[model samples]
Target: MQVEVLSCMRHPNMVLLLGACPEYGCLVYEYMANGSLDDCLFRRGKSPALPWQLRFRIAAEIATGLNFLHQAKPKPLVHRDLKPGNILLDRNFVSKISDVGLARLVPPTVADTVTQYRMTSTAGTFCYIDPEYQQTGMLGIKSDVYSLGIMLLQIITAKPPMGLTHQVGRSIEDGTFHEILDPAIEDWPLEHAMHFAKLALQCAEMRKKDRPDLGKVLLPELNKLRDFAEENLPMMMMFGAGFAPRNNNTYSNSAFSSSTFQVSIIFSKQQPYFFSLY
Candidate 1:
């Protein structure tokens, strides 16, 4: 299966194959300097809080990568396990989908036998697993769409899909969408944020047929978000101030004198008032 998948790899958005040691069952890929998006987004203190613009960019990249896989010639790949862990990022933060362990080629057979004959095998992480796939085990391109939606939600909300607060059903039911966004990003453009969130919600819909195709799921919306960000770069910069470096030791030389003067004024006011009362 690994050999077959390795041989099938041809997309530019996918991680390049370095070599595979068949004897050891090891496949080496081009090392992404930033590691997996999962590591950078969820790891405590280790992962930088991604800015809204960057998050939108990452989401767009992931969508493009998935679209290429699903639409590729000869054999369209179904990445059954599309999750943050499988999305690797380079130093520039460009995303490439990796770990095709659960990838299955869409067989050319036209019969419904493929669905009826095959035994159900759950192939993805629980949090990002397509709910339809979970129930029916009928994997298709749409399943990857669902997973990508979950990942998009993760990027926008800055919350792990399975986190206690951001659990799948609860987030939708409570309407506490802000709870999912990363705290590091204090302000996000209202239109962009709401639009992205709506798309994510559409992706996560339980009905398989209702979810948007990859083309519909990401491209148009991402382009709009990109345009919005470009137009409001100044506002984003202002909001990003907390992320900027501040020298903790750079205090004014008059700091102590200022503090003393404030204290003296307070005491002087009280002393005069007390004496007048007496």
Candidate 2:
């Protein structure tokens, strides 16, 4: 199942599975130089934490990747688990969604009878899992949206998701977003930063239907923020530089397709972490 899914995926934001060896029971994937976003966000004593611009770009890159997954040619694939640990940053800090091993290709029929599938067991990291999916195992693209919501919050606050959903809820209610933000970025524009925080809060809406679509709502907002970044390039330049999409009114397929490469064998501890309860 894992091999089938990996072979079919082709997106710049998705990890390219180079090869798989049945005899050796291994899969080779393109190497990401900066390691998981987990390290960048949580590593103690690490030099110069990821700055606001890079974090903003990472959010857009991740949304672009999720948009690709949810809008694939044949069927929308759902990354059952989406979290900082599963997100890899390349040499340039471009965020790519890894761990396709636990991915589920939502069947066309599933939507028609989603409620019927409620008996299905639930599985995902505790904090990141969709509340709806947890109570009733009806999985959909919206599940990924909930997870991305938490990830966006983490990117902004440099904090973990555990208890964060509620924390942000209170922050929003009390109008104290500035208090939760990481001190490293305290100097960033307050209104702009709150706009992002507010969007993330929306994505985590308990009802999946209320959460914004990755491609339509979330991605566009991220790009608008990018446009804001472009206007304030000096802010990003203060930190290490990273990717900003080319200025164009159109979106192209090649804009997202991964460059294919070859690999015969692979061995590593950093394979996709697959977990399922059903």
Candidate 3:
């Protein structure tokens, strides 16, 4: 299942699946120099903390990846699991969505609209999961949107998602939204951050129907934020200097002596056997 889904994915924001081996249940992906967003966000394993600009870019990149998956041809795919751990960063800090193990392909009958399928059981991490989807067992593209909202909030606040929406909401209502902005970001643009906070809240509305359309609404807004980040490229470069992991060497299929190279293996009864060659 993972292989079939990954084989059809091709986007800069989506991780590239290089090769697969069904017998070994191994998967190889492009080596992410910086590792998962989780590490960077939490400063785990001595990972450098992410700056506001990079965070903005990562949010937009994740949104772009989700948009691609939701608009896939014939049948759209919903990434049932979307969290910082699944978002990997390359040597240059480019964000790419990974771990499609829990992805579900929506049927053609409802792919073109905002419809959902009632799965027998729920899947995904706790805080990032859509409340509605978890409660009703009905999944849709908006389910991923809800998770994206949580991630967006996480990017700005650098806080756990356990009760983030409520905290942000209270802060906004009390005209103290600035307080929740990650203090690590010394120069957080209060105005822009406030706007982003509002948008994140919208995406996390309790009802899935209230969430904004990913491509039409969220993508454009996130792109604007990304552009704003790019406009401040100098600041990002200065702040992020020497933070990226070493060994920035890049690889391509053509660069390899053989057509394939495998790095990791996994055994799972619920997952397809595959390898992502880096």
Candidate 4:
């Protein structure tokens, strides 16, 4: 199953499956330098926290990969196991979806038949799995969207999906969503952060019909958020307080000391990037 699914699909954001030896139970795959997002996110002390920029890029990359899988030619594929651990990162911090052993292809014959796929076996990570599909065994592209939504929240908050669902869901209900944001991110534009987080919540809704279409809804929003984070915000803003204005449209920053982020870089009319001393 792994070999069949991996060989059939090809995309820049997907891990290339080179070969597999069933006799040895070994699968050859494209080498990922930075390793799985699981290690990068869960093992904080052992591995550095991925900077928000990289995290945001990886999130969008994973979404693109899933969108491709869910919209593949011949038949749409469902990656039953989609999670941070299954997403490998290259040297450039590009995210590629790995581990397709549990993938399923929705054939064209049953493409329009939503009530058809009622499998007894349940797959995918518990936290990232869709509640509706898990309860009814009625799978579709929306199930993948729900899982991706959980993964999105994990990328944003650096918290596990299972725990984050409760913490973030409660915060969203009580209007305290900012409280659960990962402490590693010292400074973030609240409006932007909430925009992204709320979208995740919508994707992981209990009802599949309530979730947004990946291509039309979620992807555009993610692209906008990624652009805002990557293009607008300075690198220094990830670690300290929000950007403060100086004279003549110049911007100043605060200080910080951390593994992935350090020092303050101020933006000025004369110097686009200038180091400031604490």
Could you say which candidate leads in TM-score?
A: 3
Q: Considering only N, C-alpha and C atoms within 3 Å, which residue pairs clash in candidate 2?
A: none
Please provide TM-scores, in order, for all candidate models, with all chains considered together: 0.73, 0.83, 0.85, 0.80
RMSD of each: 21.7, 5.1, 7.2, 14.5
Give the residue spans of candidate 4 off by over 4 A: 112-116, 233-278
Candidate 1: TM-score? 0.73
The CA lDDT at 54 in model 3 is: 83
Summed backbone clashes in each candidate are: 2, 0, 9, 0
191, model 3: CA deviation in Å? 0.6
* Deviation (Å) of 75 in candidate 3: 0.2
True-vs-predicted CA distance for residue 224, candidate 1, Å: 2.6
Tell me the tens digit of each residue's lDDT in model 2 across 140-161. Answer: 8888899999999998888988
Q: Please provide, for model 4 over 65-146, each residue's C-alpha lDDT reduced to its tens digit, 9 standing for 90 to 100.
A: 8877776666777887888888987766678898877777776456445513566788888988888878989777888888
Worst 10 residues of 4 by lDDT: 250-259
Per-residue lDDT of candidate 1, residues 196-252 (tens digit)? 877877787777778876776466777577566556556546534221111123211
Ranking by TM-score: 3, 2, 4, 1
Kindly report which residue stretches of model 1 are placed more than 4 angstroms away from their true locations once superposed: 43-45, 108-119, 163-176, 230-278
